[model samples]
Target: MATWPRREYFYYFTKMMPTGFTLTVDLDVTATKEWLAARDLKFNAAYLYLVSKVIAQTPEFRVYRDNTGQLQRFDVIHPAYSVMHADDHSISSLWTAYDPDFTQFYQNYLADLAEYGDQRTPMPKAPQSENTYMIGSIPWTHFTSYTPLPFTPLNTFFPVIQAGKFEQEAKRWQMPLSLTIHHAVADGYHVSQFFEQLQLAFDHPEAWLAS
Candidate 1:
């Protein structure tokens, strides 16, 4: 684990805040959708893998406070998300280890779904790991803005991301993505970096799809 310098006032101030801030933006996902469709890949799995890949490259996204109250950075971050079952219309929490390899990650994700997708009760909360982020998808609606309710105010270091429905505009497809992160761990610049990286990935899906 790595720690940020005490002299970073922004980190100190934002970490002490009662709540985190959210930013929402529309992302062009035309290339991504096309790549996935060509390979018969699951959209959610591919998108989630892209998100994890970007987060792994951004150190700020991995910064979080440990149980001992020490700020630390994780070398790897996992994803925890919700999956809906088609059988009973139930939702369940699913946690999957992050893998840079899209194929491996997608396989593991499918395995988790097959094992617990039909379960009505929420899966036991995974042990709190500062290296994990919460993710959700709302494929039913295309939204311009979103605000996520905090599960806990004390530990808002890890980010919460929600991907809304995709819309077709002429020759392009766009997705609404909302990200909530603790201001202490990152600033607007860091958020912009994430979005920029994500957009690049979407624009060139072949770069990731072949990995």
Candidate 2:
């Protein structure tokens, strides 16, 4: 295992090698009565917690990867976040990635906003053939729309945000998933288990609240 800071090049030349395809059913956020009773914070917190736990313990999820090469456990969940950065400025909050503590995360989020009140930065230009680059000192006027789970690759991620759907994106959306893997880490059953865990967490979110 390597605990290494990402290389600058790591951000550049970003293309993944995909090996396997495991189809999944998307759970409707409001499909069941139990979902509302569970509360929004409950599901959101649990989902973040579970994703954090899985990725922290399993390095594979962090890699832009696939598991077609090995028969190991591919049933792990990865973290995908929605960040709203625009052509002109820096984003003050990264609340979507916080794990297990919404109170602190929300507090910090507000703090960032307050401290940088009305501060706006010029948008950084993106390279040719890509959408706008959305990171750096934030613009005072750019209204932040959202920062949530990243359901797809970076190149193809923003469109979903524009459309506002993950289940539809994951299953029916035009974008395809790409993963590069050595295949030694996971397999079919593992991929199935990943979805099962997600469903279980959604079904039983009361058990996921912080005490």
Candidate 3:
């Protein structure tokens, strides 16, 4: 666990707003589809890979408070996402460690699906860790706005991310991405940086997918 500098304003600001905040934006994912189609890749795997890769670059996204009330930044973070079961029409939450390598991440996601995809009941909650981010997707709808459940007073700093259905228009695809973060750990500047990085990843998937 790494603490923020005492001089940083966020160090004091987070103490007051412990529950955090969120932001939602729509993004062009045309290049993402093209890149995946050229390589015969699964959209969900590629999309999550890009999202996780971009998130790994932002330190503020990995901030969390310890039991003792000290803010800590993790060197790495993983994704804990919701997976729907086809057998029972239920959702199961699963967690997988993050890896920069797209192939490894995709394979791990597949493994997780195989293990929990058919379960009728929810899987056990993932272990609490400073190095985890919450993620989910609603593939059936293309929404303009989204709001997640309210956060408790001591909610962890892990960012919650949701991706809506992608729509095709004039040979291009677009998707809505909603991100909720703790205001104490991140502000508009940090959220803007995250969106910029995510767009770059979507615009140039070949750069990261090749490796």
Candidate 4:
């Protein structure tokens, strides 16, 4: 009989998800520039990639269950955003969870994380997801509201925006982003890193997006 030299489940503890860790961040910026630019959609596309990539790599964005949990880092993320197509405004998403290129991810992630590090963490980062939410399409209008906060439901935001109450509601919800990260591959600092990186990116949008 031949003996196999390797075991498959030796370090199985690192594959579990963490709980009780979710994070929220509030980004305050005006889409006024994005709206005016002929490539406003282009700007939004770049912004989404820049933001999602960072969230995927930073360990802090990952949610950790309480102590005594098994499994390691999950190494994934999910992104939610609104889009437009077919001449109709819609909301869409691209899940960043389980991206294979983490090194490049970190490079992008770090760039944006450095920016909003000064803000507060409203919630712990949630666990990483294997799923994603994709909204359809969107069209520019005088009532377009692009804010970065309020873990409030999407429906709530939409109606309010159309009601011409975007600014008021934005102030009310405090405009903080909420996320859940899988605990298999990261800790809490990654979330903090994410915001910090974002601040850096917004501050230097040109250089940040060029990379």
What's the number of clashes in each of the models? 0, 28, 1, 70
Tell me the tens digit of each residue's lDDT in model 3 across 1-211.
2444532556566555444567888889988788889888888888778888888888878766677876676877888777886666678777777788888998888887777666665655445444767788999999877778863664467678999999887878889999987676678898999999899889888787777
For candidate 4, the lDDT comes to 0.37
Number of the top lDDT candidate: 1
TM-score per candidate: 0.90, 0.39, 0.88, 0.40
Roughly what TM-score does model 4 have, to 2 decimal places?
A: 0.40
- Write the residue-wise lDDT of candidate 1 on 1-211 in tens digits: 2344533654456545434688999999999899899888899988888999999998878866677877677887888889887877778887888888888999988987877677777874445444678888999999998898765445536778999999999989999999998776677888988999999999998997676
- How many clashes in candidate 1? 0
Q: Order the candidates by TM-score, highest first.
A: 1, 3, 4, 2
Q: Superposing all C-alpha atoms, what RMSD in Å does each candidate have to the true structure? A: 2.4, 12.0, 2.5, 14.2
Q: Rate the local accuracy (lDDT) of all candidates.
A: 0.82, 0.34, 0.78, 0.37
**Over the stretch 1-211, how does candidate 2's per-residue lDDT look in tens digits?**
1333333223333434432232324443332224434554433334345444434444433343323421122233323322344554443222233434545543433453444434443322112222211212111222223333445543221111111233334333221111222233334554455545545544554453333
Candidate ordering by lDDT (highest first):
1, 3, 4, 2
lDDT of 3 at 146: 76
Best by TM-score: 1
lDDT of 4 at 100: 35
lDDT of 3 at 108: 89
**CA displacement after TM-score superposition, residue 194 of candidate 4 (Å):** 1.2
List where candidate 3 sits over 4 angstroms from the true fold.
1-8, 11-19, 124-130
The deviation in Å at residue 125 for candidate 4 is 28
